[model samples]
Target: TFRVVGHFNTGKALVKATCGRTFNSESDAQTFLDACASAGHVVSSIETKPSTKKPAAPFTTSTLQQEASRKLSFSVSRTMGVAQRLYEAGRITYMRTDSTNLSDVALKAAEKEISKTFGAAYAFTRTYASKSKGAQEAHEAIRPTDLSASSIDASREEQRLYDLIYKRTLASQMADAKLDKTVAKISVSGRDEEFVARGEVITFEGFLKLYLEGTDDEDGQDETTKDMLPAMTEGQPMTRQTVVATQRFSKHPPRYTEASLVKRLEELGIGRPSTYASTIDVMQKRGYVVKEDRDGTPRDYRVLTLSGTAVQAETATENAGQERGKLFPTDIGLVVNDFLLEHFQNILDYNFTADVEGEFDVIARGQLDWRAMLKRFYAPFKETVDTTMEHAERASGERILGVHPESGAQILCRIGRYGPMAQIGGPDDEEKQYASLLPGQSIETLTLEEALDLFKLPRTLGEMEGKKVTAAIGRFGPYVRYDGKFVSLKADEGDDPYTVTLERAVELIKAKIEADAKALIKVFEEDETVRVLNGRYGPYIKAGKLNAKIPKEEKPDDLTWERVQELIEEAKNRPKRGRRKKS
Candidate 1:
């Protein structure tokens, strides 16, 4: 026997249950259901309530990146870069700010702009308090320098981001939106289960007229919240519709995105507004985490009955063009995280990091001495580091798979200097071979079957002109080798080099050879013997150690000795490249 609890939103429902007694067999559940068949049940009560949705607070550094990612599909780095450029160009105010408090001047300008553009009814004179724990009150939230400047000469990306800032700033000062919330309760005829239905209708748009803040949900918002319920009374008669019983399994927590990670860091008070972008940048550069394009396929599917037959129909797939950017830990990342967790638990602990951040904040506020805080933290940290260096295990991430079937060699997965790699045989063995794992494949989850498949590489693809041609996976991807030349296989269109036929390999090799042979254009008739060649950067003339680009009007083949001499002379007088001095 079991007890069931349910919560509903409009037509949507979520059911939860707790087992009262163990059922060894299906007959036990059936016997309990038979006993409860004669019991009576009915709708007890239905209620309606009014709710209000306040306008979102002005965008902080973290919130801006989060919204830009959702609405503009911009990366954290890209958003910050564009914002920096905008700030320098006087198109916007300082972008690296945490406080949501608007300046009196900016607030007055916003009121005028909102009243003039959206009418006086849309404008509301209100102050938004910053909810961030340790936000810097001196700096205001991101906003435009001039509210009346509706257009700017900028790139498309800059214009899109500027518009988002403008709308959000204007909307932040708007009135709270009014909503009519309705909730219904229906009890089963024979069971004690009471199902609830909830819905909300927007009575007043208010700030929604200007903007609606984006959510972290992959599907954006709940559709049930927008749906209206049928006219229900206190004890209305209810009829049973088709029942759906779905079996679902719990899912692990989702991986973090750049936006979500920034949000988390801000929430934990781990970093300040100016450091969020740099922290994410350093992580990516060090290859601790990678921004991977993940498939955002939802789990919900609809059921349609046709001619007494039930058919499952899937909803339309979303995030088609807007591929979700998810951060995945690489093998090196996993190793580094594990090592830190084992040896430096205090440093890696969330609460410890947050507390340290609080100490920094105290120092900034002049409530605590900076040197004292450092002394308190550094002593134990140094001791721990010194002790851990002698006892920590090597973070090689090496594990043994079963032996190979044909060679009887032991297969091992390990993190090499470059990346995670699989090997057949050991260093002591005479015939040891190594292969890199494919992108997205990890050493931890790679199976023996997959490892064996890597050994089939470096496959011979017949001979060409008395030279052996072979296909192999290299550090830079798949390639075909012939004679002394290596030809890269184009796998962009789903072509696999492992299964590429000899004919295709020969074609690719020939194409590469032809391309390499076509680089030389002509030799100039000069004492310096300047040679003109077609290079990747375009046609250019090389004279000894110096090189000069050929003009578009003058082709490499059409260049005369006089033209070559003039180009070389011109290149000699050109300014040399140098590092820019800081202002």
Candidate 2:
């Protein structure tokens, strides 16, 4: 069976298109291709079925964070912080919780509010057993302290969070949304393949009147996305409106957002809801992970379009692998992870952290002997650490790339003093070259080709001001060197040292020169060391590297050499910023 892509159209109005309904093969699909999507296919069958969508469970700590992240664009810590403020103001219940169970009074309040606001039919009081057995924090799910007012008069963030909690709590006690789903099976003129068109009509709003759960995967199509099918008989002929098959690629596992990361930890029992925020925060603080919005690279993919019994192939580009507010592992994170996995695989196992967490919980409840639990884990863990320290070689996360094509020097990618970098030739070699790995390029994933590409830098863009202008990657990052002065290549300007054109490099060079010219006001021709410059605050005097502030009352040009020296001495002797002079 082959999954072919196309659309179904009646011509009156655009109804639907899909990557749905598999055809027998490519040849069968091409037998009756429609370029304008005007080909005819008989409606073989139509079926409508009733479906009910249950309201999502009331907000647990993790669920709340996940939803807030998706709906309000709040980070996990931000969500927690806002919820905490709401709780403190007595607008909502405690922010931290694992239970989905609503208190008896809270449930009654939700029931009353749902009945009054949405009518008696919508009020279907329901109870949810907490999915997590080891529930932490408050027993009740996070909810509005008073359900009568779904929204509160507060700061925007707090109000938004409270509204969410209120709606979730109220919706949890409401009836399921009723839907009528219709599927039309169309028969191709010359093939056994069946063309399918789907439509869904929401018959009753129910809990949907208040809230719909936010999804982590935003690209996924939902049942609510389809419209009502056009009135048609089983034997009626239908014209295809739009049918284009854009290639779809399999996606890698998504990087974790703070909320999703919390959910995962909850699922694995690795950490409590209270610690989830701190756990994510600590990784970033330790430089193990970065929470950033990365503008993903663009790539081209093939497109197959069927127009009037003919297929047209073309290429289209898309921003691929784009991520927003996601946690990405740094180069050091990978290196450290690799080292830990090799030296202490047992301790690094996911189950180990979860089991220890459970053990701690047991100790807190006085069910397990705390000392006994620690002794069991500590003995083996300590032995492994000691043994590994003594016997294991240092882990640099080094990868020996193939020899350079021309020089035949062995290339290697590894963590150096500054950070992860590619190196050519070892210590014994007469000469060596090194280049720092580009941002988002990890030592573990750096390919030999990519590593070699790094060495292509230090490129000569052309001569400027009688000096050769060259761009190269350095310890700090990519920069351009000209006339004994270096200018960093700004990432925001989309400058890549390796691929920067001579024109762009010259533009940057000129911009830097213009900025320096504006900054330097005057030079002491006699001393050659002292100069008047416009610093960040205002005009200042510079003698070598030392800076002395030029008082507003005294003009810099009016100051004599002795006065300038006296001022410089005064600046040097004055109490350093953030320091104190002895009384």
Candidate 3:
């Protein structure tokens, strides 16, 4: 049964309570009441009038930060700290809010005061109204609760907050902060760049009276605001104002502080007014977040920078055909992302995420079938999960390439630029040069040391003896070798660099093969692709090559040339096997 507390002009109660039951009309409600009455039930009604209690002044420093901190799990101290600065420094309206409203009387008083303070033309013709919806109707917007409020004297920390709120409230009520906004959009080459400036000319001092007072309260005012700007009109063109062309790279993910987190949560629609504080608290406790400090010392810092997004910020932008950086995903996040991207790709779809959220809203209002909706979503999502897991082994093998932020290069080097590559020395073959050589087609002739020494290579090799097609070889023997080819170790490093013999060419090839082998060995460790086999030559019998025989026995044991030969024979004896099943 439902009861009505207040009635409307159409004879419908303005306030009604339905006691967990549905009512289609007044008649239906009447029938239920009649039934109850027949069964010995009694009903009564009461009338009350609304009262007019002045709401508290607009949010004050502590109050605003407290509410924001609680909703955002921001520390109380952090709330006041930022708010006080915003208030006294004039970055925002007063930080604290306690006043209930901006009195019509106060509004008129402000207008009169502004007209007297500045020229009458500078005063606003109409009152400023804050129609921001869903705000507590009785409470005032976060503004100066009192226009006549004076600058606060600093005695306690709380005074700082009071000063910020007071000045902002007065500032808001006095006038619109005048700004000489300048914007320039220029095209260079094929790209376009925009520059903007928010400057002021001949600032109306009336609003700034409160600003100045507040500035004194928070901290000393800076020189920028002390002088009035030169006057200028909207259409008038100004001088360059010192034009500058600066180079900048794409920015990384911004570090999140309490203030920024609140902003982001508001943007995502993930939390409501009452739940923000709890969310922040939980995040801190979970070890998923920490406050980053400016000087390595924690000085009332409250910003939270997610360790993962740090990587994502890199490789976000680049020139064409570049490998981007990988956003370091947490183990769990990586698994979830991969699974969602593969099996339930639709779940990753923006439309699907939105539709599901919308359905929840409908369910809350009983406008949609809850179980039916659940089933509809569960079926496809479940199928996708199953399919993903079934093929997880194969899917995990795929690699993704992205731009590297630091070098802006396609290849990623694990070690620093000075790290070695596997190679044989050619021109500058020093002792430390052994580790830097690697086998790959080069754009220029460079030794392993030279390549590693220089972080990057020129597009083409400039002036080097190795670049000449025919070079004379003397001392060791007469030989002619191509300029771009790797210098053969056997090549006579003498007067005649061009002339080379067949013996020298063979020696060079052998040296090249050895160098490549050493490099490959470094890449594969014992834990990775390493296996020991018996030597047919038997323990370095001489500085000569020897062939190892295949062994018998399919079972694993101590490796020997005889055993390897026997195992090879056994394998040949067995029937051929088919491929193993995938996944």
**Candidates' TM-scores?**
0.80, 0.78, 0.32
Clash number for model 1?
A: 0
Q: Write the per-residue lDDT of candidate 2 for residues 1-583, one digit (tens) a residue.
A: 3345556666565445443454454444444354234445778888989999999899988899889998898988899899888888998888788888888898888888888888999999898877764675456788888888866789989888888888888899999999999988877665555667788899998999998888777577766766788876798767764456555566899988887888788888888878888888889888889999899789886656675566776778999988888899888788889899998898889898888887888898899998899899899989999999999877778888889988888999988888889999975898899889988788888888999899888898888767799999877788898887788898897988878887887888889999988998777667877888887898899987798988899886687878888889999999877756689
Query: Candidate 2: where are CA atoms >4 Å away?
Result: 1-28, 32-40, 136-138, 239-246, 292-320, 404-407, 427-432, 445-476, 480-487, 494-583
What's the true lDDT of residue 581 in model 3? 93
Return the top candidate by lDDT.
2
Residue range 1-583, candidate 1, lDDT tens digits: 2222222222343322222343343344334334333333234676777777777877788899999998998989999999999999998888888888888998999889888887888788777777666776668888889988866889999999999998898889887777887766666565554556666788877788888888887644452256566666666544433232222233466668898899999888788888898999989989889997866555442222111123232333233223458888889999889888888877888888778777877888899999998898899989998888887778878889889888888899989877899999975788888998887689989999998887788899899888999998877788889987778888895557679889898899888888866887897455635788788899998898899988888768888888888999999999999989999
Whole-model Cα lDDT per candidate? 0.75, 0.81, 0.38
Q: How close to the true structure is residue 173 of candidate 3, measured as C-alpha lDDT?
A: 51
What 10-residue stretch in candidate 3 is worst by lDDT?
Answer: 4-13
Candidate 3, residue 419: Cα displacement in angstroms equals 31
Candidate number with the higher lDDT (2 or 3): 2
